[model samples]
Target: MHRCLKIPEILLTIFQNFPSTTYFLEAKCLVSLACTCRDFHAPALDLLWYTLEDLVPLLRIMPDDLVRGKLDPSFWRQWSFSRPLVPSGFERFDYYAPRVKVLTRLSISIDSLTLQDLLQLSSLAKLTDLRMILPDDDMTLPDVQALDHDGVAVLPALLDLHVVSSKLANCTALIQCLHRCTLESINLTLQNPPSGRSLGELFMVLSQSACRASLQSLMISAHDELSHSDEDIVYSTVLAPLLLLRSLYIVVIDNSNWPGLDGKSLQQMVLAWPRLCYLHLYTFELGTTHHSLVTLEGLLPLAAHCPNLCTINLGLHASFKMTESLPGRGVINRNVKLLDFGHSTIDIDAVPHVAGFLSDVFPCANIISTWDEDEFEEDEEDEEIAMSTAWDEVISLHPVFVIARHQERFAY
Candidate 1:
């Protein structure tokens, strides 16, 4: 009977060792073991509660209605939605308040109602990190403003705040709210078109703020819709403010519409941003030689300014001529680490030119070439044998040279 008793203890030890196992597996095992006897029920319930406590907003939102429905009756009998669900009133808070300490990091992508619910449930005073994605609706501005007013004081421990969107009307107000809070780091993305004041207002806020000193990483993307005249205005406003930033990501869409910065403007922007480490560009409509080439030409001088830049992601309409003209010195000499060219045909003719360009501009960096497989097969191989076994061999034989350097790298 001593050997039989030891078997249960041995199994318990095995379960304890595998703490990193998936929540569903742990929950299922606990439920199964709990059904056997009263002694196993407590351990099983503790494991389930601990697993639920660690779940973030994203995990909570996962499509698990089917799994919840399928759980055995005994598992559902003791399960308490009141514990995990965001508490609202003081009565609900009293029941779940003790569990609020379990939440260390909170990330929410929802509207004001959900945000309010979260704040009401957990005391924001203890939160160390907060990442929120507001809905793409007009009503979000006021709600965000309200949240800033109410929660900013309580979130003294908040070290990081990340906000992503295409458009925001009261961005200046939002920045002001952030300034009130002692944030150590912030990541902001602008994807929506803004009217009235030009894009420069954002940079102006950053440059003028007390928070700028604390900021370690900055990403700015002008919406694709800004007019040529307005685009220049946006960049002009941002240049002076971004000088102190250590990390910067700037994306300009539709190169043809861009008035194309002159060499001096390029020099000023690059020289101003001395500490910049990473640069990314996504240019659309590259075939139009007059405008696209001029825009691309402006980028070469700017690329020379980033002394510490280690990674560059360039997504442009593929062209052998443009690739041949890309700047070579700074990226190659600085030992740039990563280069990504999105969905470009790498033919025998263009491949050599691209290789030469990479060797020149980003010589130390790995050149990652990516193209749609369907398009690659269609363009490079003959129609008759394109669907056959030989087509796979032919395609594999090509030296595509992706940054990751293998097919598995492309796997999501």
Candidate 2:
């Protein structure tokens, strides 16, 4: 082989160019290259095992007699051991497990081996990003307990954790497992709004654990109906502890109301993160009776602080009265490119004032708002239509104000 072909970077680039649109085809081509010579074996195998969407490929490495499931087509992606697992079955598993860096779409079945069994088999030393769907029905008390022992994380090197589930119980259990790892990003989507206790525990684990110092991005979304009790837990109480995470650059919370989120609370939250670049807090979906206590005035602090902030979305009640004496009158934030106020109501008469105010605060921001078509009632349709029209007017009128402000500044 030529000296250039021997270079690791050159070989990797060549392997990357191989067709990847088809998994089995790519695997076959890599397998052929691996068999061709000892030089190509290691790198070929590394790319093949770099990302495992599921554990099926790893389990396929075991001896045919040791594991079973070919009897039925339903269990194609799943398998169970025919007999008690022995160390010999893990020889091939041990070799390839260390190569995995990203694991996603992992599904745990109640009938199959538990997470504890997998963790015991290999530490997955190189696994850095893990996304799993933890079914509440498949998880057991012992399975979760297995991860809580000795303060040792199952995936110690994990940095980004993404959990999407309809239930909060299993999601909470999985998060508790990573207390020992300093995860940099956490994206959680739950169908049900977490109870105050669950939310407290979740925040507590992130704040008190190794994650507090290293966490940079957090995105939590609850897609179910909000109850009166759920409304009482203010966002500040559950999320304020995160202020210690000075490295936080992005924060997103959707359909979760912050009952007491006023100008003071907003100011405190925005000021806590100097590196904040994106702030998206959609407290209430459109057409809902619920509205944030914050008005357009609440956003003034964002202009003064958060220099790196570029994308902003907040639910605020915009009215002409507040616009008359808008806070941070002269303060400007040119970094902001788009301002999305979800389900926020705007008085028809206040469109011009709100537009000019936003232009002054976020001179470069493009204002937009959206409503949930499914949430509006027949009687409220007219009101929502009016609100949508008013916000549309603001969007149209904003650029004119932006130009006029620039001219005024130059004239000064």
Candidate 3:
């Protein structure tokens, strides 16, 4: 143990694995090590502040000498920043802000910080991955004027951004700021959008940005998926510029018919990008009358052209197919692992045929008939009988039919 003590970088690397059920356990353990001795202090703190769970914790550690707000802003029924400030004093936030490379603020309630303190976060030069979940506690928060246009909220080197908030969702200024930075990934979740173009400008910003070449992944959980076509501003403004995108997920989180991309649109999109590996282009409509359904025949282009595809969830059903999997798929079968067939609302016996078809098409694949995680929880026995029977048809030939329930995504 003493011989390996010299390799602090190795020690730091080992402690930074992605946290599972116990996400904060490693951070807490690091804090304990920091208190052990001066030797462990620098390394532990370096790793501890590398990625933060929330900005509130960083705010909490600020020095007492700085001026503090009178009311606890988190629980406020009504609040407004009189003015963005130039604070006369500084504290722990300044010390730790630069070290915070990847920061997550789930339901941001900047209770302790004034506008000045909040604005100071913009100066984080090393900050790359930023995820902010705005708290719905204040209805007036959204109505409040946008943050001062003085580059206070602009993240200079931001590479990845995941923001889930109704207030921040529609801010054109924020989108404008984001356009200036080169981002690799962007995930957004917004609710109660009164109009379809709530995210229109943001899409336009990403599409027209210099970051288009560098961007790889994009996920937008909104009122509706962006529709494609020259007439459809989103496709022209968003998807058109994203030629190199490897992953694309645009689904309406809450069933809303703000109109999404249909089968024709998807096929057109696949032709535009050859690098697509993961796709979840489910129509947001929840009723039987929806016309955006994609027949199994429609996936031929995807299987033939975008050979790198590994995961898909187009809500597919077998009955819609006009044809079968191509005679010999020349494209390399990249061992696709998971699929979401949310539209496989077929008869009991038909499940095997649809599942078996998918297994044949993607040789190494698992089918998820639904994205609703809890739908089959209580009926485990029935699910096994149904799922196993479908897999049995493919397992004898193509051995990769292992299906696992969709794992819940953790916020960080």
Q: Rate the local accuracy (lDDT) of all candidates.
A: 0.46, 0.74, 0.52
By TM-score, is 1 or 2 better? Answer: 2
lDDT of 3 by residue, 65-94 (tens): 433444432232222233444453335667
lDDT of 3: 0.52
- Give lDDT tens digits, candidate 1, residues 56-124: 322333334311222321121111133344333234334333333345456555554345463553455
Cα RMSD of predicted structure 1: 11.6
TM-score to true structure, per model: 0.51, 0.73, 0.55
Model 1 steric clash total: 6
The 10 consecutive residues of candidate 1 with the worst lDDT sum are 71-80
Shift of residue 81 alpha carbon in model 2, Å: 14
Worst 10 residues of 3 by lDDT: 403-412
Q: List the residue pairs that clash in candidate 3.
A: none
Candidate 2 TM-score over all chains jointly: 0.73
Off by over 4 Å in 3: 1-122, 135-153, 167-172, 192-196, 222-260, 320-334, 344-356, 371-412
Ranking by TM-score: 2, 3, 1
